[model samples]
Target: MGNNFKMIAKTLFGFEELLAKELRNLGAGNVKEGVRNVAFEGDLGFMYKANLCLRTAIKIIKPIQSFPVRNENDLYRKIYHMDWFEYLSVDTTFAIDATVKSDNFSHSLYVSQKTKDAIVDKFRDTDGKRPNVDVKHPDLRINVHIHKETCNVSLDSSGSSLHHRGYRISTNIAPINEVLAAGLLLLSGWDGQCDFLDPMCGSGTMLTEAAMIACNIPANINRKGFAFEKWTDFDEALYEKIIAASLKKTREFHHMIIGMDKAPSAIRKAQENIDNANLTDYITLKRANFFKTTKETEGPLHMVFNPPYGERLDRSDLDSDFDVEEFYANIGDTLKQEYPGTNAWFITSNLHALKFVGLRPSRKIKVFNSHLESRLVKYEMYEGSKKAKFQKS
Candidate 1:
């Protein structure tokens, strides 16, 4: 507790609250929400746990210093004076990731160049040598952000974003990111209590994430590694302990997790990925056309998926002879006529095609699928009857 310090977890636009809640659940202190980010206080072990467990966060960064800078020279001087030897040395290879949202600094690349020059010069003056810059795989990844006149320097603890969750080595076209998949399930209020299904499951990302959430498994438990592993102060024993403790906290999931897709290729890929994650026992995969099938699980089925939104309003997942309008309408028909007693949720960027669904969405949330602005919608289907329970307009 005495070693706790402020850390920032960066997330997608609509996931700020979700990330904050996750931090608080993980026992973070002074949790606060920011735009596309959540700030909290935690120690080194908590930092490791957050990186391993957070499903919505893209990166966890530890701020080392902050100051006011008037120009590039000011930035260079301030960054040069920091204790570089504490994190890097003459033999270390580092990279600077710069972001400029300021009227003062026009170019992030220029800022990165100046920061790099200052560090190299400081090292050369002291030891007559400097570390080389490795952009692809760096020993130390420094974050430089300039907003208005304030400059904040941080260390990137999670490399290559938390979305690279080491599972789903096989992916379909534009497969949902692991982080986004987990966020969607969480947003839909899925808690492993009921049977879960991804009707249009692609590459089994949603299925894998759902299984993990259901069983209390860590989000990045399968990740190859994090940037913190390369830091000079990394503690292997402590990290092992954190992992062991997290695994021990995992609860048993008795409910079923199912994944279905029309494409046999998709089913094969999903199964392979699921097996890779050691979740084969927890998830069931099959090749079935969702529109042609009815719910097999009894009692309180939960569904979350992303239907085809078409490629830039051009090619869609439907057959060339089939129309996109009919594709979306079928999704509505299946939910209203077949999947009763379920909370059906899906995301799509095609707002115009959504009108063809006919049924009114119980909830519509604004979110982003990659860069495209989209909506995550919910439609409730009660158990009494098909047409009567699922309200159709």
Candidate 2:
């Protein structure tokens, strides 16, 4: 408890609450939610555990300093004055990623360059040598964020994005981001309680994440490394102990996890990824068109998927006279007629196509896939007419 320090976990839009709840469950203190980010308090071992176990975090940052900056010079001065030796040695390499939302700092790239120069110059003056900047694989990654007149400098504890879970050796054309998939599953209330399905399971990301969550597996168990491993004060034994403890919490999952894709290539890729995650025992993959299939499970089903948005995989391409409107309508029809007692959710950037589905979404969450703003919509299908309320309200 005495070794607690502040950390911020960055996430995609609309996932702040999910990330905050995850932090609290992980035994973090001072948990607070912000826009697309969550702040919390934990010790060094907890930091390692967070990096390894957090499913929705893109990166974890440990803020070292915060101050008001009027201009670029103030930024450089404040950054240069920090105790750089505490985080990095002259022999180590580092990188700076800067974001500017203030009128005083216009170009983020230029600010990063300036900050790098200040740190290198300070180190050179004191130690006669400076750490090299390695943007690709740095020993220490620093983040500088300036909003309005306030500036916060933090050390990025997760060098690469946590989504590079290392298990995905193969991917299809429209492979979903792992963080996005995990967040979507969490948002859909998927706890391995019932059978799970991702009908359009490109690369099998959703299926793998679902299995991991069901079994209480650490999110990054397949990941090779984390930035904290390169820190000056990294404790290898502590990390090993944390891993053992996390693994000990793993539970047995009785429900089935399945994925289906119309394309055989996608099925192969998904299988390879699932095998890589060592989740082959928990998940089953098949090649079938989702629109033509009926629910195979007997109990309530939880379905989450990302269908073609027509921007990339155009349904119109398959049939020149294809009515995308009718296709989405068929999707709604199939879910209503074939899959009863199910909670179906999907994401798409095309809001117009969404209306053609004919079923009112019970929940619409605004999120992004890369740069495109999209909605994660849910449609609940009841077992009988008496329970099947048509309207979202």
**What TM-score, over all chains together, does every model reach?**
0.97, 0.95
Clashing pairs in 2: none
lDDT string, candidate 1, 1-393, tens digits: 789999999999899999999999999999999999999999999999999999999999999999999999899999989999999999999999999999889999999999999999999999999999999999999999999999999999998999999987898878898889899999999999999999999899999999999999999999999999999999999999999999999999999999999889899999999999999999998899999999898999999998845553446554669777888899999988888888999999888988988788989999998898999999988886455744545
- Candidate 1 clashes between residue pairs 3 or more apart in a chain or in different chains: none
How far residue 382's Cα lies from its native spot in candidate 1, in Å, is 0.8
RMSD of 2: 2.1
Candidate with top lDDT is 1
For all candidates, the clash counts are 0, 0
Per-residue CA lDDT of model 2 for 171-231, tens digit only, reads 8766789999999999999998899988889889999999999999999999999998999
Candidate 1 accuracy as TM-score: 0.97
Per-residue lDDT, model 1, residue 332, is: 93
lDDT score at residue 87, model 2, on the 0-100 scale? 89
